[model samples]
Target: MPSTLHETLIEMFRERPALAAEVLTGPFGVSVPTFDQALASSSDLSAVMSTEYRADAVITFLSQGEPVHAVIVEVQLGPIEKKRRSWPAYVANLHSRLGCPVQLLIVCPGASIARQCAEPIVVSEPGLSLTALVLGPDAVPVVTDSVTARRNPELTILSALAHARTKRHRAPVLEAFLAGLDIFDQEHAELYADVVLAALPKAARAHLEVLMTTTPHRYQSDFARRYFAQGEARGEARAVLAVLEARGIDISEEARERIADCADIDQLDVWIRRAATVTKADELFA
Candidate 1:
């Protein structure tokens, strides 16, 4: 089952199919034929010869109504031995279906997992092997410039999430993310913000909170207003847990659910203070 982060990463690529091509040609330095349009292709790669196979996303690049290149985007959070076998099959099926060159792009947030994913996979035949093209932390560019972030907001979100925890890049990445939000409407922007917020640590999240609050009133988007108005309690709720998380405290699902369901800022604040010295998560309510 796909986690929220996994699904969101795939959605980012699907939201802007061209972004996958850009990442490939720009960062991955893989040649992709120039195309007039990019569209989502059926991820169902199942054929009569094989069982059902579904890729996370399949983007087809077309020129003059004919297929030029296709990309399979996969977001892998951890190493899965089974993927090594299934991924090669995914490429083979997609290639046969599209009758075009297919690139397997695996997006891994962890460098270690990326390294593992990049390892060559040998099929049933002794000689045949396939290596995944991985996009990991080191591969993701630090998107600190507002102009660049706004121009490629989806990419910027990936960059922000990739580097949100890095000490040097945290502040700038969050700032760029805020600027990038300008390109989206309230609903979309809010959703993106929530994702970034979920990735940040205590100090970095606080910095983002400051940046969002300090923005000029005239420059604030509807999303910005909604964030301050409705998101404060939820953000605080997360903060209390984030503090405990940073302290390496163990939390039960019941306690986690309690904090998550809370909407009172004052109560969350008390929990936040209590979270700092608590040996266990349940102590927050004690």
Candidate 2:
């Protein structure tokens, strides 16, 4: 089963197919042809072979009616030896299928994983090696300005995920992230928020929670409303935990699980008040 993080990153790339090209050209300085549009291609690279080779995403850049370039976007959380072996197959098979130049882009959140993915894969052919273009935390830029975020919301989400730990970058990045949410539909916005919030450190996540609660007026659109609802749920979940922690209560794994699993606003509210006065963390549920 694909984790939420894995699916979210792949969905982001699928939502903004041009993002692959943009990252390649912008940070990695790889030359990609100017395309009028980018369309999602079949990720299944198996060609009548018993073995199935599927990539995370396959985006093709089309100029007029012809395919100019194709990109294989793979979101890698950790170093998998299996991936190292299959990645060459992904590139070669995609190139053969698209009948155009293909590039394999590995997206890794960790610096060490990025370095690992960047290592060359030597092929059986003499003097031929595949070097994957990696976009890691180091490669992703800190998109602070609202205008830039609005212009490329997908990239902004990626930026937030990469730079969420930096205190100086958090405010502007989050501001842009919130401002740019209007561009996407409710579903995408919520998923994007999930990815951004999950990537943030504790301090940064708390800061974002404060912003969401204090500035409800900023989010007036229908899409924003849905996004805010999700944020509110997260805020409420934290409130239950915070109250227990403030009173020096030890939260058991089961107690923490119950709090996290509770999504009902009214129920959580009741628990929140109980948490403040309860002597035992588990007593909040009772």
Best by TM-score: 1
**Model 2: residues with Cα > 4 Å off, grouped in runs:** 216-226, 229-286
Across 162-203, the per-residue lDDT of candidate 2 in tens digits comes to 786788788777777776776887777877777777878899
Q: CA lDDT of 188 in candidate 1? A: 78
**Which residue pairs overlap in candidate 2's backbone?**
none
Cα lDDT, model 1, residue 36 = 98
- For model 1, state the Cα shift of residue 12 in Å: 1.3
Count clashing residue pairs per candidate: 0, 0
Q: Please give the CA lDDT of all the candidate structures.
A: 0.84, 0.83
